[model samples]
Structure formats: structure tokens, C-alpha cells
Target: MTKYLISFEKGAMDHIPEADWPEVGKAARAVCDEAKDAGVFVFADGLRYDDGDVQHAVVDVDGVVTDGPYPESKELIGGVLIVDVPMREEALRWAAKTAAACRCAQDVRKFIDGPNNA
Candidate 1:
């Protein structure tokens, strides 16, 4: 089994109206349930959008520590789902389902050395 990450960029769903969130949440939860039923779900979570609640930590080679997210990137990971699947195609299929459920595009990528990897 290979572990894949299925995620979407922060603010990708900003256009969604607040009134429709319940429906969207339902759809997203359904996908998660399906994944769990299929025995592919490893873990999943959504991040808080508030910057005040988010703290970034960086450790330097000499053990120096800094705070803040990457200065060059505007996009953030809004949510993520990790799954252990047999192949890339299977991961892509899950990503498609997730995209539809979230009403946003998803980015799928395999982990270099995941839990299932020896």
C-alpha cells in the first residue's frame, strides 16, 4: 500500500456561500465515511483559517528558532486526507471524489516514506 495526500489550497472554497456550508460539510463527511468503509482512510483534518490561531516554527541548522510561515508562499493547506491505497489511480479517484464533495480542486501526491512503506 502507498500513502497519498489529498488536499486543497486555502481560500479555494471562499466563494462558497456561508448558507451552503452545511450541505458541503455533509458531502465531505460522506466521502470520508466512504473512505473509512473502504479501509483506505488513514487520517483527515481541516485547518483553522484564523492566522492568529496559527503559529509557524522553524529550526535552523544551529538550533536557532524562528516563527512564521514561509514568507514566499501565499497558498496554504486548507485541509488534508491521508489514505493508504494500492495505486496512484486509486488515489486519483479519491481525489476526484473529494474535489466534488468540497466543490474545489484537490492536489494528490504520494508520500516518500509513509506508514505502509517498508
Candidate 2:
């Protein structure tokens, strides 16, 4: 099996009204359930939007530690789903479902040297 990451960027769903979130959540959860039923769901999670809710731990080559999110990009991962599947097409299908449920674009990529490949 190959592991794939399906993710969306922060603020991707900002245009969605707060009132519609419950429905969206329901839709997304349905997809998650589908994945679980298919036995491809490794893990899934949504990140908190509040900056105060985010904390980062960075280790430098010198072993110094820094706290905070990556300074290079304003966008962060909004949510992610990791699936262990046999084919890329299957992963893309799941990503499409996720995109539809989230009402946002999904970025799908395979992990390098995943699992047994190593």
C-alpha cells in the first residue's frame, strides 16, 4: 500500500458562511466514514484556525529550539487525510470527494518511500 496525503490550505473555505458549516461538516464526515469503511483511512484531522491555538517547535542544526509556525508561508494546512491505498487513482478519487465535501480544492500527493518502500 502507498500512503497519500490529501490536504487543503488555510482560509480556503473562508468564503463559506458560518451558518453552513454544520452541513459542510456533515458532508466531510461522511467522506471520512466512507474512507474508514473502505479501510483506507490511516488518519485525518482539522487544524485550528486561531493562531493562539497553534504552536510550533523548530529544531535548528545547532540544536536550538524556536517556537512558532513556519515563517515562510502565510498559509498553513487547514486539514489533512492520510490514506494507505494501492493506487494513485484511488487516492485521487478520495481527494475529489474531500474537495467536494470541504467546498475547497484538495492537494493530493504521495509520500516518498512510503511504508514498505523504505
Please provide TM-scores, in order, for all candidate models, with all chains considered together: 0.87, 0.87
lDDT of 2 by residue, 29-60 (tens): 99999999999998898987476764556789
Q: In model 1, what lDDT does residue 103 have? A: 96
RMSD list, candidates in order:
2.0, 2.0
Task: Give the poorly placed runs of model 1, Cα more than 4 Å off.
Answer: 114-116
The digit string of per-residue lDDT tens for model 1 on 3-113 reads 999999878999999999999999999999999999999999897757686555668899998765756655678999998999999999999999999999999999998
RMSD of 1: 2.0
- Candidate 2 TM-score, C-alpha based: 0.87
| Top candidate, metric lDDT | 2
Q: Which 10 consecutive positions of candidate 1 have the poorest summed lDDT?
A: 67-76
